[model samples]
Target: MPEANIADRFDLTNWKTESLRMTAFLSPGSPIPQQNWWEEICGSPPEVRSSQPRTGVQQDEGLFGDGNTQGRLILAVQPSRIDWLLTVEVVPTSFELPSVGSFSESANSFAQLMNRWLDVSPNLQRIAFGANLLLPFEDVEQAYQSLPAYFPLNKLDLKNAQDFNYRINRPRNVDYDISDLKINRLSTWSVMTFTAFQFTNVGSYTYSSAPLNVAIRLELDINTSIDFSGELSKDELPKMFAQLVEYAKEIALKGDIL
Candidate 1:
């Protein structure tokens, strides 16, 4: 309900989400996914490869769905654990980032996928969910005023400020049936502009019509506060994601991680 409350404030009537990701840290010695899993899970064949350790990228990746309804899903296999970071934006080119259907939609989608992955590799060390929400300003000035008075900006003059960014990270606990879980909540807000290349057909060629979009962005990264020594089952990931979504809405609206 707190997330729904955003439209009522922030001088914005609607909100959009983009680049939503759910991450699962697979436990050590877990089974790596076979090729068939990639085909079945990704909806189509995936671009997977061996670990390029020389490149120094900790997580070797397997990517899926590049276009805008399918979104993006990445398998970042690290030395300690494999991270499943995914989103649902697979479609045509757009001027701006597309919504992940809704805040709750992403939670369900990610949970379902994680559930299936668990069948192949059943142990999880940690879970994380991240999302970027966009709320447009009727006038840019409204954004500055919307900044909470509690922010440590008393000394800095904001009257002439244009581009602004503020972020805070806090630890929070979610009530759980098994045990109350501790997690870290990281929230960041910024006023930003987006630019895209637009083209129109002119005979056999295309003409450029560069377009720009501006809005307020809220980024959330909530994950288990600490890794577990023992393995966690798949049953808890959905609940974890659900709680993460709730906390995200609260922190976004409250403007602080209280």
Candidate 2:
């Protein structure tokens, strides 16, 4: 990755989070009853579902939500890992982002679910927390010019910079209870023009294209280091989540200024 040199502060008005997720991995895993696990979180019988390929990596996906909200809660599980996606559309029927109040409320709701899951699940090899956010631009030309502000493309001409992306993965020592515990901080951000196409229905789908849109898309993933072979106890999850959220906010807020 190229070094990031601060040039100018980018405008962060109208920015919003696209989604947030928390995941836990259990090595030497076993298949738990899908219905039992679903009922644990939802406190209701599992709804309609489908099975995955025999060799699939991540299997058993169940979506939780009513049709009235802007997003749905997704619980996807593989043999070794369980993922909880808090605020993302199932098929993405719209380009709407969560409002300020809603985003905060969503985060709080997600945390509640995370704590609930931790109460039952145990012996996790690793844990991860992530966020996806968007900061829209008025036009493509303006977006192209603003790329250099938060990205390391100040030396290059924006005219030639198409399909631009900047990503980095590094280890940071977290100030937590565990001794010498390092967390992997991964982030990817881009400024691009997007063409939206709405997908209707499932299996067989029809699409209709919308107007072109430009925005700065940001992704941040914070997780425990793979180097540590030890497992994280259930009691440690809430504190771990808090620490990860702090790190995520620190990185995500950088685009607001430098």
Best by lDDT: 2
lDDT of 2: 0.64
TM-score of each: 0.68, 0.72
Residues forming the 10-long window of minimal summed lDDT in candidate 1: 1-10
lDDT of 2 by residue, 1-258 (tens): 132345444433345657778988885554543334557777765444445757444333344443322455667776677887756543445453332213334555566667778777756878888887676777766666765556443354566466878787756887755677788888887875666677665555787776777777778898998887776756787888877766766665554222
Per residue, candidate 1 scores C-alpha lDDT tens digits across 76-157 of 6554565666654445466554555444455456667765765565467777778787765555665555554324323234
Q: Supply the TM-score for candidate 2.
A: 0.72
Position 258, candidate 2: lDDT: 23
In model 1, the runs with Cα more than 4 Å from the true position are 1-13, 28-36, 42-44, 47-70, 87-93, 97-104, 147-159, 177-180, 197-211
